[model samples]
Target: MTQQHLEPPVAAGLPTPVPGRAAKPSMRELILQAAAVLFYAQGIRAVSADKIITKVGITKVTFYRHFPGKDDLVVAYLERRAQSERDAIEGARRSSPGDPAGALRLIAEGIGVESCAPGFRGCPFINAAAEYADAGHPVREVVASHRRWFKATIEQILHEIGVADVSGVADQLVILRDGAMVGGHLGHRGDPQVVARSLVNAGRAVIEYSQAPD
Candidate 1:
């Protein structure tokens, strides 16, 4: 497991408050952060609101003030994760302006790095989707929304790369990424870096295949 997993959940990234010095996190952020850690480590359904309240050292009143219900907290947790992912992908694009392939490579590398991290447990979206089987559920909506954005992003990149019929290719690339994440977490696919390279290569192959003459 990663060092963060080994540490106390509530203390994962909390700063040591100095005497009259460090700025304290707002009660909302503190509660949300605690819930994010637990929800990611343990399944969302497995971690309860009371557990989050206890971990944050807050009363039911305070917890409810920030999040009206467990679903509220779960949605917030997923939205936070989704924002982080969006930022990462945008950053990759910015880092490789006008170069779709380079941005794609950076994206693969980022996923690879996450897989190699200790306590990696595959994709957060996938995990959440598994627990939330209802199509109309809020959590599933969040997952579906994020996935739509991701697939559209890939489709845009492929279009820029001169690949025709990118719809199927984009789907293939996303599936390849999903497999790579799981493979990296399972550690049964040889070295972690190899798994990452395979993702990049597989992505490129899909793009190239779509670009080929009929």
Candidate 2:
């Protein structure tokens, strides 16, 4: 007797399987991509697993198979954002090797460009944290971790630039960055270039002030 392997039933609107292999995205990737867009465009709390399933054309079974629940998916979404940020910062550092100020400027310029883009929303981590107020939640942990990394990165840069108060300067720069992101999304009065220039100038002043002779 031959063993029969039964394939899962395909839902309507979802891609049908081919004889050999299906030319479709992996269920996990599809869920993550769809959720990322929805969470960013529409707040995280506003987007539900059912909505994601509808958007991705996947069944509940598929979503659950990839993620245990909504919280799991949210964590994955944050992790993706964190990885992207780390990569961008690393690229800036590599592009301006040994020039901490230049690297910082690159990051600020990138943020400004993103803030001015069409359909621009505020920072993903900030948005997520607002919705998931529980600091102990996985989503909040990811946000906090990213923030810590960002602050530490700035401190290191300030220290390299010979700043006297690395900790204070880093804190000021982080605050300025948060403000820029909020202003870019809400204010929208000035050109993105103007916003970018202002951020760079402010960051530079922080470093300069720290370096000034007391």
Local accuracy of candidate 2 as per-residue lDDT tens digits, 1-214: 0001222322434666788986565577678778878888778888889999999898899889989999999998788778778878889989999898899899898877777766667788887888987999899999999999989988887777778788898999989888877775685756778878888998888778777778
Find the candidate with the highest TM-score and give its number: 1
Stretches off by above 4 angstroms in model 1 are: 1-23, 187-190
lDDT of each: 0.81, 0.80
Candidate No. with top lDDT: 1
- Per-residue error for 210 in candidate 1, Å, reads 1.2
- TM-score of each candidate structure, all chains considered together: 0.88, 0.86
In model 2, residue pairs whose N, Cα or C atoms come closer than 3 Å (at least 3 residues apart or on different chains), thus clashing, are none
User: Any runs in candidate 2 off by more than 4 Å, and if so which?
Assistant: 1-24, 187-189
